[model samples]
Target: MTLSPSETARYRRHLTLPELGPAGQERLKCARVLVVGSGGLGSPASLYLAAAGIGTLGIVDGDRVEPSNLHRQVLFETVDIGRLKAEAARERLLAINPEITVVAHAFTLRASNARELIERYDIVLDGTDRLSTRYLVNDACVLLRKPLITAAIHRFEGQAMSYVPGRGPCYRCLFPQAVEAVGESCADAGVLGVLPGVLGLIQATEAIKLATGIGEPLIGRLLTYDALSLRFAELPVSRRRECPVCAEHPRITALEDTAEACAADAPLSVRRLSATALRRLLVEARRSGPGLVLIDVREPWEFDAGHLEGARNIPLGELRGRLDDLAGEGPPIFVCRSGRRSLTACAIALQAGMAAPAHLEGGLLEWVAAIDPRLRLVAG
Candidate 1:
């Protein structure tokens, strides 16, 4: 399709580039990119892709904006807190580039609808945060033979990679099986607010490169970024001959939900206790029995910042060795910045034969949100 007068004026800088000339711009104008998740990573990714003139941009998200999201999810404003993310993102993208078509799939991407949604787009961008969703997206992209640009962020680091079906390694090739231990999300681990913006823009760059056929994308390689150190590293990835998906004779011919897989890997004894419930437990124990032991599993630095008044600090890595130290204490409640490391601590306590220890449902984050609004929930 030929560029219109307004489009030419809008993309004059991109058109003038030797690598991505008018023809490349036309390719971008004809591309259909689907971004799954309108959260931190998806926010900047969709914005830049829309600004770059991707013909049709589809955003899939079932969540509504929250006040907490305002820090990193740049697509929405304070007024948009209760609004659906996909819808809000569409409005924002259209305001930025009215010429492009923005489609909002304001629902969660599930195995039942993943193939249908992904097949509609030329390329898929994995902006979702869950391990189950990431695996599902990877398997679907591999089976449908679609290019996928994926990115993930934790506290101070993030990684991005591209999977071009037969051209490079799929996500499963690099990670043969899901590691639930390392699956802590930004919500759980506490991410640097600006980290996703940097990584999301990188995802946008790779998508644009794939659409415009520009410089070599991060296919078959993982690009990792460290926000604290400000360092970028590229790690080579090789296709596994025995990979369940994208192999010579693939074992997985159909899509499978990864919820069961993740669940199977999770510890059975790790139970979640909401902040209100924990507070009640403490109150009840204090009234009639020995008080409950509240253990803060975050590092000393995190503990020094702010923690529950009576909570004892026991970092997760040191919890295993200190199991005997808490043998005779009341039922322990593990807490962390988010709840991830606390869950690990609970598991460790249980493995050491501690009875029914639980982690804070959302860690100290929930505590700050529910029990004590005055406490500051710091993000790393």
Candidate 2:
């Protein structure tokens, strides 16, 4: 894999690095990597991989770019709204480095085509948000014996792990069973805009190391990152002997769609108050002398970041025990970063004998999206 004269000049910085000289640069030029998502994490991971001269790169996503995605999904621009993520990301990557091959897989990954799609690449980077799709990618990568760099983000936190076939445990080895859709995901639990960029770059670094055979990859350990605290910790992970996915006598022989692959949380049944409607109510109540009580279920730190005025900071962890304190507080409208915790809060309210429970429809994220971010935001 000889580098072209132009490529040599383009990767001068990489060539100068002792760890990744011309030989490593050539390996990168010949490596083929597949990034399974084009959102937050995948955006930075794929962008750097492309810029670093990965020979062939694939972007797989069926979602279209929306204004909401622009904050974290840096691959797409304002004009790219409504365009397929993979398509938009492919264009961006090519524009970054036309010297490499960029392939856009503008469809969701499913059981039927997971294996075939993964087989074409030397390494797999799974940054998908769905549990089902994450498991599917993990299983397919294990079956194909391709090294995988997988990472995920939650509100202000993220974790990454690598699986090199016989060297370390697969994603299943860490969590053998997929959970039925329970609780809110990051989509429902809002995340800081910059969190994924940190973990995504870790994925890119791991992929580069795996591609060029330098530096120890994040195998046999789960690397965790806390954005708020600016800290990183590692947890040791070992393969399970009775594990179904990657064990001595594995039960997961084929990539059949299991509960793990079909996992999603059950839909919630609760009264949702739209941000617009809530805003109107707040305005009316302000003029009429505090008619509505807003209960914020986010953590203290999140509440401190920004919250609706007149909201009470009752973190979800303390909501259940403090149910009796709201005896004379009137009907409360719960809120959180995303609507999930608020829904949970509503359920708790119902069980505590409240006839009805209501929450901000999209949480604070939705409010910010619909209204002014800086307006009416104050610490509880």
Candidate 3:
């Protein structure tokens, strides 16, 4: 394909590069990339890919732009808050390069639509934060045999890798199963605003390399970046012989909804108690019952900074090991900075034979927001 006069002027710098000359530039223009999730990583990755002249870009996201997303998600403006992320991202990408086609999928990426959406794109970028979405994207890309560039950012650290199904390891090869205790999200744990920008750009760079066949992609290797220490490490990874998705006798022949995978490790017997209901339960227990034991499952540092008064500290990591401590305590009410860890804790308690253990609905955040605004809230 030949570049138009306007296209030549626009991509003059890229065309000037010997490694990515006219031929490579044309290849990029013919590439169709789908970026799932218009959050932190997707923001920069999609922006750079569009500016680099990817012919067609597909954006998938079901969420709306919140004020909190503005710190790192550069695709939306202050005026765009409350707009659907996919729509906002499409507008921003078009604003960056009107020559490129931007397709907006203003809905969640689920098992039912993942394969169909992925089949239309030459490459897929996994920028989602949820574990379920990550696994879903990976499985879909693997099944469809499409190149996937995936990256994640947590606080000041980030990691990224590229997966090309027969070329090297898939995501499941690296993480055979979902982690039992999922880590806190950017909202709960707090992330440096520029961290995802750094990681997303790397993912974009890898995607471009894959499209243009210019540089060696990150297949069979994981690149980790630590912003606090300013270190970059490339760890070698290998394909697992027993990988369920890519193995000789693949177990997961069809796609499944993995949205609940994060909570799969938790026991099914535990029940959820809203913040208000928990307060009432605590009051009634204090008057008539044996009394309620409110356990804060956050780390000691988080509890020290600020926590619900009268709650005992027991980190989630230590909960399974220290089941003896709560042996004779009243019906346990697990809490955390967010509700996730506490829910995991409640599951642990139930699995360990504790009867009728419950977790605060939205953890301490909801408790403070609904029951006691006077309490200081700390991010996990």
Would you list the C-alpha lDDT of every candidate in the order shown? 0.82, 0.83, 0.82
* Candidate 1 RMSD to the real structure: 12.5
Instruction: lDDT for model 3, please.
Output: 0.82
For each of the candidates, give the backbone clash count: 0, 2, 0
Q: After superposition, how far is residue 170 of candidate 3 from its true place, in Å?
A: 0.7
Kindly report which residue stretches of model 3 are placed more than 4 angstroms away from their true locations once superposed: 183-186, 261-380
Candidate 3 lDDT over residue span 230-286, tens digit each: 877554567878887988888888888763533222232355677888888878877
lDDT of 2 by residue, 173-288 (tens): 76665555345544667779898899899999999999999999999887867786687755566786777778888888788665542122221223557788789889999899
Give candidate 2 misplaced runs (Cα > 4 Å).
258-380
Please, what are the lDDT tens digits per residue for candidate 1 over residues 1-380?
99999999999999999888889999998999999999889999999999999999999999999999999999999999899999999999999999999999999888999999999999999988777888889999998999999888777778889999779889877665555542333355677889999999999999999998888989877686778768785555668788888899988889877753332122333455778888888788778866668899888887888888778998877888888889888778898886756765765665466766777866778788889988766673
Q: Rank by TM-score, highest first.
A: 3, 2, 1
